[model samples]
Target: MRENPTASADRDTPPTEWSVDVPETAAGDGGSDVRTSNDRLLEQYRRRSRKKSAVIVVIAALLVAVWGYAVVTGPIPVSLSETVSVLSGTDTGTAYQVIWNIRLPRIVAAVGAGAGLAVAGAVLQSVLRNPLASPYTLGISQGAAFGAAFSIVVLGTGTTSGSGPILSVIDPYLTSVSAFTGALTSTTAIYLVAKYKRATPETLILTGIALAALYTAGTTSLEYFATNTELAALVYWKFGDVSGTTWRFNALLWFVVAAVTVYFTRRAWAYTVLNAGDETARSLGVPVERTRLFGMVFASFVTAVVVALFGIIGFVGLVVPHIVRRLIGGEERILIPASTVAGAALLLSADTVARTIISPIVLPVGIVTSFVGVPLFLYLILRGREYW
Candidate 1:
């Protein structure tokens, strides 16, 4: 009798049986095989992610400790123990008052603003897929500046000359409102421009840059025509001081930060899907256009609030996200939260250095952030080019 083809093939291959019931050799088994493969891959990824997260947490803790030390042991030279005691409300003295009341709020402001701007930057960069994208690059900051300048140059001057009570004549609330309005307006314009032919990254970046230039020019013209006292006020505002921020201001800052953080964090999953390309995201049931629009608007609102309070603190949004991306990879789920923490630490350290580098003559927080951010950003660009 002639040997059967299937039996002959099996026997020639190996002594091991190749039955249809064999788990690894079964035909029409692709679904199960794929599931197994995916399960293994996912487990490996989770393990790697856990290790990376631990490392990041340790690094962040160390940085925070260093920043705290710098804040305390500045030009004034307060001990670490004394700083902790003061912060914890167990210390009582003029030194405590100065640190707690004056420096503390400034530090808080820096941390809050830095984190907010950084997250905004990361979101925009991922959504636009453009490295040049940032809060300023997207025209939000310029729009905010215009609103603030308008209020200071026109409304502020008008009220100052005829003021009975400063609060009654012109409220800071109005300035913030104007900034928000301008920010939304600019955001809408950019979105409309970018959405013309399917929302390409290049188109969005170009539109943002064009609108930013226009807003900046408008702000400059306003500054030029401002009255003498208004000019002085506007100059101070433009430098982005964190000094003299009150509890009320801090509360407002906290509220806005919390709102933005919660909103972005919830959308972290959507952002990750979004980074995978619009077509892919849409195929997977993501409303690509809606998600992008919502994220941009929410981020713009945050930027507006920050600029309204602190003036134009540039580069934090641009620099912080790139740094975070390098540290944590391009997954927005990780990038968003990581950027927030890293940005806060960076700004806190910068603020500490700024205040102590010249005691009683503190530099603008904006100046300090840029001083540190620029060199780091340049290094990133060089490294990024090499990587590419």
Candidate 2:
């Protein structure tokens, strides 16, 4: 050992590898702090999401329940069990006939119209980024009114003679066709304006307001020139009604609403991205302008179908979407679907109330929707503009 100095020195030297000995308390505290923070954030998110979902579900359920009660226990006073039995096909009495044949169709129409309008409103608001945007706001309703009026005043008269026999042969289908054409015309005009302006939100809103006013004036002039009977008919049409809609009309409405809903839902995620900003969406590879155009066209189509079927049922499209947005975050994914459910519930309930409140003399469903929807909407607006 004495002869090998280098080996001796190596043996005497301490190990070069280093090791850190952390204090147990310090390590435990840091880990606990990190986990606590994570847990708090996650819990907060869960609470928020749960609250939102719960509110939507509760509101929808309440609406349906109240509507069901109203439908069963009206002036005619069918029992709940009887209503259920009729729906299930176990009962076939006169009561059942009344319920199944008359009330059911009206209910279906109300629900379909409500859902269609609400989704249309949501699409318009998201695309335009304007809370005020709605089916009526864009002149689609007024345009439809003009078309229907034109058919009743111009086409109907031209097609028929003053002779009772000849007038009796005039087809109602012609009026429907005219209304649809007017809706399409308005839609095309709005689309062109939106496109020419690069689909900017402000441009679309301003264009829609101008066109709506124009269409309204045109409809008013048509009404002014209409015969007394024709004016009465036009006036009734403006009030809106689901009472006379047949199953065929309901089926058509459902098909259109379903198709539009599917198309919109498919692009919902992209819509969420678009809401962040056009440049942001473009940067993320979303076709911002194209998506906006598609949304507008699809919404317009839904509005056209609804207006054609039930005349100008106002406020459903404007009110439902804003209410839904307050419950759910502004994400289109949640907003669109929620609006669909919420709108249907609201409209169905309103229709039920309209029919039952006056007993044998049913009020127009549109009147009820506007009466309830306008006050609620005003309250929301007064409370805060940013609620949407």
Candidate achieving the largest lDDT = 2
Q: Model-by-model lDDT, in order? A: 0.74, 0.76
Considering only N, C-alpha and C atoms within 3 Å, which residue pairs clash in candidate 1?
none
Candidate 1 structure quality by residue, lDDT tens digits, 130-194: 67678877788889878877876777722333332111114556777777787887888877776
Total clashes, candidate 1?
0
lDDT of model 1 at residue 288?
A: 89
Cα lDDT for residue 33, candidate 1: 74
Candidate 1: where are CA atoms >4 Å away?
Answer: 1-40, 157-172, 197-203, 376-388
lDDT of 1 at 268: 85
Give the per-residue lDDT digits (tens) of candidate 2, residues 162-264: 5321122134456556776777777778767755767655567677778788888998898899887676666666787777677877888888888998888
lDDT of 1 at 145: 78
- Taking all chains together, each candidate's TM-score versus the true structure is 0.81, 0.78
